[model samples]
Target chain A: MIDHMSALFTLGNMQFLLRGAGMTLLLTMIGCTAGLFGGFLLAYARGSKGTLTAPLRWGATAFVEIFRRIPFLVTLFLVLYTAQMIVPRAPLFWVAVVSICLLCSAYMAEIVRSGMESVPAPQIEAAEVMNFSRWRITWMIVLPQAWKVILPSAVSYMVMFVKDTALASQAGVFELMFAGKALANRGLDPFLVFATVLFAYFVISWPLARFGRWLEAQLARRTHEGDRR
Target chain B: MAHLDISGLEVRYGTVPVLSGIDLAVERGELVGLVGPSGSGKSTLLRALVGLVPPAAGRVVLEGKDVDYASKASLRGLRDHAAIVFQQYNLFQNMSVLDNITVTPVKVRGRPKAEAEAEARALLARVGLAGKERAYPDQLSGGQQQRVAIARALALKPALILLDEVTAALDPELVRDVLDVIKDLAGEGITMLLVSHEMGFIREAAHRVVMMDAGRVVEVGPPSQIFDAPTEERTRAFMSKIIRH
Candidate 1:
C-alpha cells in the first residue's frame, strides 16, 4: 500500500490532477458568477406584480421550480443530448456549462428570492407612501438591504457548486473526479486516486466556506454598527 | 371648503372591514388629532390616503381637486402632495439620513440633487437632527429616527402629512423630542392628520381631536372638549382607559 501510494504522488500525476482541478474551478467560477446574475433576473421576474407580468411570473416560477427538482447528473445528460441536437456539434464543455448554469440559477434564484422577501412589509410600505416607483423601491431600498441576507447564502452556494460540477465528469467534461477515474482505469489504486480527488475538492471549497462565514460576520456588524456607506 | 376632505372612506381586506365609511375633514393648515383604541383603523385611514390600502369606496377631495382611487394618475397626484410618517419610523435601512430625506425628491420628483439635499439638511435641522446626515437609521434612537421620518415627509412639501402613531414606538423619554418637532410643524401652518396614543401631546398640539372607535369616528371636538368634556359615551370611555395608563 505504501509503495503504491508513494508512486501515485508523481510530478506528472500532480500536474494532471491540477489540470482537472482547474476545470472544476472553472465550472464553479462560470456557473456561480453567471448564475448569480441570471438568478436575480429570475427572482425579479418571479416577484413582479401586476396583471401584465402575470405570464412572466408564471414562467419564471415554473423554471425555478422545475429545474430545481431535477437532479444535476440528469440535467448534465439532458443538456448534453439537447444541446447536441440543437447545435449538432456543440462542444461538451459548453454543454456541461449550460447544465451547471441551469442547475445553479434555479437554486440561486430561491436564495435571492427569500432574501428579497426577508425585508419587512412595512419597509416597502414606507417607500410606497413616499411615492417611489416599484422599480426604484426595489433597487434602492430593497436590494441594498437584501445583500446582507443574500451574500452568505450565495457564497455557500458557490462552494456547493464546486462539488456539483463533479457531476459534469459523467458527461466527459473532464474535472477532478474524471481525472481520478481515468487514473484508476490506468491501473493506479482506486483509493489513492479518489483520495487525491477529495483533497483537491477540499482545497477549492475551504476558502469559499471561510469567506462565506467572514461575509456573514461583516454583514452582522454592518447592520448593527450602521457602517457609513 | 376644507383643504382636505375624506368622505365615506371604506377599506376592506376581502370580506373583513378595516375602515367603513370614515368621514373626516381638515381646514387649510389645521391639525386634526386621531385617537382610538387598538384595531380602530387609525393607521389604516392614513394608509388609504396615500393609496396604500386602496379605499374600497370614498371621495377624497384635496385642495379642491377630487381624487379617484381607481385612476393611477389621480392616486399619483394625491401622493405627489401628501406623505406619511409611521410609528416605527421605517427609514430605509441602507440609506444615510440625508438620502432618506432626499431620495423621493431627487429621484421621483426629478428635483436637482443638490437642491433637494440642501432642503433635506434644512429639514433635518428643523427636526433637531443637525450634523447627522451621514448616519444610518440604526445609528439613531427611536425618537431621532421618527424625526428623520418626519423630515423625509416634510421634504416632499406635501399639502397633507399623515402621522400614524409617529411617536408610539419611542421610549417615553424620547417621545417629547419627536412631539416637539411635530408641534413646530403644526405651528408652521402645515395641514396634518395625526394618529397618536399620547392624549396629552394631542390635546396641546391639535387644532381639533377626532376620536375613532371600531373603525368609525365616535366624536370630534377640540382637545378640551374631547379629553375633559367628551359628549359621547364611547369617546369618554376610551379616553378614561387611555389616560389612566
Candidate 2:
C-alpha cells in the first residue's frame, strides 16, 4: 500500500534521521562516561576490606543488585514518571539519559569487579612486604592489571548501550528510531524506513565491535609473549 | 640483645599446627640456615618472623622490641625492619626489572627517583643482571628472576633478610649462580636466615645450622656438627636419607 522506491532514498528524511543519529551518539558518549565513572566507584566499594568499609560495601552491593535485576524499560518508565512528579516541566531527554546511565553503571560495576578479582593474591602480598600502603597497592598494582581485563567487556557494553539508546524514542525523544517512525507515518513504506533504521545501527556498531576484537587480540599477544619467556 | 629472636613461637592453620615451640636467635652478621624434612615448618618460621604468618602464641623480638603481630602498626614496624624472598621469586610481573627494584624505595620510602634508579642499577650489576633492567620478569630464566628478587629485597636495606629456599626453583646448573650472589651477600656481613636444601651450600655458607623435624628443632649447632655429628636420632636419620639421595 506504499511506494518503497520513493521512500528508500529520500534526502529530506535521511537528513532528519542523521540528526536523530547525532543525538543518539551524543547520548551514548555522555551515558558511557558517567556510567563508567560511577561503576569504578561502585567496584571499589564492593572490593574494599576492613570493618570501616563494611557498610559502604553492603550499600554498593545492594545498589548493583537492585538496578541490574530490574528491567531497563521498567526503570526508564519509573525514572521518567518520578521526575515528572517532582518537576512537571522536566525534559524527557534528560530523564532518558539519567535512566540509561544508571542501568549501564550497574552492569559496568560487575564487569570491573570480576576483572579485579582475577589479579593474583601474591601480587598484593609482594606489595605488602615492600611496605606499600593498602591504597597504593590497590591503585598502583591491582587496578592497572585489572584494567587490561576490563577493557574488552567495557567496549562491548558501550555497543549495547548505543543500541539501547533507541529505547529513548519511547519517551517521545526524537532519537534515531523516533525519526524512522516519523518518516513511516508520512505514507512511506514501513519496511523501507525500518530497514534503513536497522542499517544505520549496523553502521554505528560495526566499528566499535571491530575495535573490541582488536584490543582483545592485542592483550592475548602480550600475555603470550610474557609466557614465552 | 639478639639481632633477631623467636621464642615459643606457635603457628596454626585452622586447628592444624604447622610450627610449635620454636625458639631461635641470630646474632649480628650471622647466616643461620634452616634444614628440615618437608612439612617440618622451616618456611613457616621464616614467614612468622616476617609477619606474613600470624603466630598463635609467643613473641618475636628484633632489636630488643617484641612485635605484636595482631596490631597493624606493630606489623608495619616489623615489615620495615625485615623482608623475605620467596621460593617463587614473586617479582612484580607488570614491572620491568628496574621498576621492580626501585618501586619500594621511591614509593614507600619517598626517595628521589634519580637516586633510587642509580642505586637499583648498581644493585642489578652487583647481582650480575647488568644491562637487563628494561627486561620484564618473564623474559628471564629462573635464576635471573631470583637474583632480581634478591636485588629488590636489598634495595629495602632491611636489618635482616629471610631467604625461603631462594634457589629451590632453579635448575641444577643455574643454582650455583644464584648461590654465588647469596655468598657475596654473606661475605658483605649481611644478616640473613636462609632455608635451603642444598646441604653442600649450607655447610659452606652457614655460620650455624638448625635441623627441624615434626615442627620442632631437632638440633642447633655448627653445620659440621649437625651434618657430621648430629646429637638427635631424627637428625641422624634425616641426614642419612638425604645423603642416600
Candidate 3:
C-alpha cells in the first residue's frame, strides 16, 4: 500500500508541494479578480444600445464561445505560445494567470449578463425617474441586486475556477499539479503523489461546494418569503 | 406657475406609438389623479415626466425649465424637486429601509449621512415604519415595503411627487394602509400626481381628475363633476365598467 504516512514525513518534498499550493491559490485569486472585471465590461457592452453595441456584443460573445468550446488545456497553450512570442520578457506566472483570466472571463460575463437580465426594468426606471446618475444607479441599485441574485452560482464557479488553475501547470507555472509531477520524477510513488493531489483538490472544492449549496438555500428562502409577502 | 406642462407629447416603443400628441398640465399644489385602464398610456405619461421615456416629440416644462434639455447634473438636481414611487415598490433590496430613504439625500444631494438618516427616520416614522428602519426591503411585508418607498420619496422633500399605482401590488387587506398614507400626504398639501385604480381614494384625495383613454385626456375636471357627470361617453363607459365590478 502507498503510505500517506511516509509522504507526510517527507519534509523536503512536502515543502515544495506546499509552495506550489501557494502559487495555485495566488493564480486563482488574480485570475478570478481580472475575470470578474473583464466580464463586467463585456456584460455592459452586451446590455447597452448603440451602433457599436452589436459589434461589441458579437465580439464578447464570440470570445466567450471560442474559449468555452476549446478544451482548457488547448486554450492555455494558445495563450502561452502567442504571449511568449509577443512579450518574451514578461514573467511566466503572468502569462499563465492572464490566459486563465481571459478564458474564464467569457463564462463570468454570461453569468453576469443573465443576472442583469433578471433585474426588473422598473427598478432601472425608478432610478432614472429619481434622476440618479448612471454610475450611481449601477453601483447603488443594479449591481447590488445582481450580485445578490447570482452570488450562489458565482461561488460554485469559483470551485471550477480553482480546479482550472491546475491546467496552468501545462504552461510551466509551478502550481500544485506541476509540483506533484516534479516529485513523481524524483522516484516518488506516482499513485501516492497523484492521490495526494486529488485529496488536495477535494479539500479546496468540498467546502466551497457546501457554501454554494448554503447560499442557494438562503436565496431560495428569501425569494420564497418575498413571494409570500 | 404650472408645476408640470407637457405639450405635443408622443412616445413609442420602436414603431408602435404608446402615447401620441398628448398635452397635459398640473398647477402647483394640485393633487391630480391620472385614471385609465391598463396600457392606456398612464404609466407611459408618468415615465415621460422625469425623462424615463424619451418622448418622440414633446416639451416637458417643469418650473419654467425644459426638462428635455436638462443635463445629467441638472437632472439629479431636479430629482430633489420631484420624487417618484413606482407600482412595484422598487426599493433598493440591498439597503436597509433607512438607507433606502437616505441614499439619494446623502449620495445624490451631498447631505451629511447623520442628517440625512435623521430626516429618513422621521419620514419613516410618519409612514408608520419607525421601528423597521434597519430592516431590508425583502424583510419587510409588501405593505411595509410600499410605505418605505413612500418615505424614501418623501425624504427628498420634493415639490412634486408622482405615485404610479403604489398600492396595486399590495394584498387587498393591506391596500388601505398604503392609501391612508397617500391620503395623509394629500392632506398635508403636498403636490402629488397619482395613477391608481382605487376609485374611492381618487374621489376622496384628488383635487382634480384627468381620465385618459386611447392615449388622450378624455375628461379633466373636479372629481365631483367627472364622477357624477362625466362629459364623454367613453368616460362614462369606463366608470360603469369599473364601478360595476
Candidate 4:
C-alpha cells in the first residue's frame, strides 16, 4: 500500500493534479458567471408580454428548450465543430467555455424563471396601480421578493453545474478528469489515480453543498422574520 | 358633468362577456357603493376604470374629459386622478409599510423623498396605522394591511377612489377597522366607488348604491331604496340572500 501511495503521491504528480483542479475552478467560475447573466436576459425575454416582444419570447423559449434537451458531450462537439467552421484555429479552451456557457445558461434560465414565478401576481398588479414602469416593478419589487424563493435552488443548480464542467475534458480542454486520465495512461495505477481524482472532486464540491445549505437557511430565516403574523 | 361617467362600457375575457353595456355615473364627492353577488362584475367595473382590464368597447368620461383607453397617456392620466384598492390589499410584500405608501410619489411622480415620506406618515396616521411604517405586509393583520392599502391610494391624492371589496377579506372583528377608515375618508368628501358586501354599512354610508348582476347594472338609487325597497327583482333576491346576522 505504501509503495502504491508513493507512486501516486509524488510532488510532480500532485502539482499536475492541483493545476488541473485550478483550471476546472476557472472554467466553472467563468462559465457560471456568464451563464447567469445570459440566463437573466433570456428569462426576461421569455417573460415579456405583448405583440412587440412575441418574437423575443418565442426565441428565448426555443433556445432554452433546445440547449437543455441536448447532451453535454454533444454540445461540446457541436461547439467545437461550429467554432472550427466559424473561426478555425480557435483555442479548444474557448470551445469548452462556449459549450459550458450554452449548457449552463439553458439550465439557469429555468431556475430563474421558476423563481420569478413564485412572487404572487398581486404584488405586480399593485405596482401597476402605482403606475410603476414594468422594469421598475420587476427590479424593485418582483426580484427582491423572488430572492427568497430563488436562492436555494439557484445555489444548488450552480453546485450541479460545477460537476457538469467536468465534461469539458472530452473536448481536449485541460481539467480535473483530463489530468487523471493522463496520469493513468502514464503507467500509474488506474484505481489510485482515479481515487485521488474523486477525492479532489469532493474537495471542490463539498464546500459548495455546505454553502448552498447555509444560504438556504439564511433566506428562510429572513422570510420567517418578515412574516411573523 | 359627473366626476366619473361610464356609458356602454364592455369587457370580455376571450369570448366570455364579463361586463357589457354598463352605464353608471357618480358626481364629485359622492360616496357610491357598488354592492353585488359574486361574479357580478362589481370588481371588473372598478378594474376597467383603472385600465387593469381592457375595455373592448365603451366611453369613459372622467372629470369631464373623455378617456381613450388606447392612449397610454390618457390611461396614465386616469390613474393619476383615480386609484383602486383591491380586495387582497395587494401591498408590495418586499417593501415596508412606509415604502409601500411613498414609492409611487417619490419614484414615479418625482416628488421629493423627504416630502413624500412626511405625507406618508400623515396618511398612515389617518388610516390608524401610525406606528407600522417599518413593518412588512405579512407582519400585519388583514385589517391593518387593508388600511395601508387605503393609505397607499390616498398617497396619490387621487380625485376618485375605487374600493373593490376592500373589507371582504378581513376577519369579522377586523372588518370595522377598515370600514371605519373608509367612512372617515367618505366624510372628508372624497369621491369614491366602493364595491362591498357589507349591506348594512353601505346603506348607512353610501350617497348612492348601484346594483349590478350578470354583466349589467340592474338598479342605481339611494341606499334605502336599494336595500329596503329595491326596484329590481335581482336586487331583492340578492338583499334577502346575504345571511346578515
Highest DockQ: which candidate? 4
In terms of lDDT, model 3 sits at 0.81
Candidate 3 residues lying further than 4 Å off, grouped into runs, are: A1-26, A41-70, A89-91, A113-124, A142-146, A176-200, A214-229, B187-189
lDDT of 4 by residue, B1-245 (tens): 88889999999999999999999888889999988878999999999988899899999999998999888889888888898888884898888999899999999999999999999999999988889999989889999999999999999999999998888888999999999999888856579999998888998889999999988999999988988999889999888888453
lDDT of 3 at A170: 81
lDDT of 1 by residue, A1-229 (tens): 9988877899998889999999999999989888888899999999888789999999999999989998999888999999888899889899988998898889989999999998877779888877777888889888888878998999998988898888888999888888888899988999989988998999999998999999999888767334542
Clash count of each predicted structure: 0, 0, 0, 0
**Candidate 1 or 2, higher DockQ?**
1
Which DockQ-derived CAPRI band holds candidate 1? Answer: medium
Q: For model 2, what TM-score is found for chain B?
A: 0.98
Q: Candidate 2 residues A17-106, lDDT tens each?
A: 999888888888887788888888898888887798999999999989999999888888999999999999889899988898898789
Per model, kept true contacts as a fraction are 0.68, 0.45, 0.66, 0.61
Cα error, candidate 3, residue A79 (Å): 2.0
Q: For residue B52, give model 1's deviation from the true position in Å.
A: 1.2
Chain B alone, TM-score, model 3: 0.95
* TM, every model: 0.94, 0.86, 0.84, 0.95
Per-prediction DockQ:
0.56, 0.35, 0.43, 0.57
Q: Residue A218 CA error for candidate 1 (Å)?
A: 2.5
* Over 4 Å off, model 4: A224-229
Per-candidate Cα lDDT values, in order, are 0.88, 0.87, 0.81, 0.88
Residue pairs with backbone overlap in model 2: none
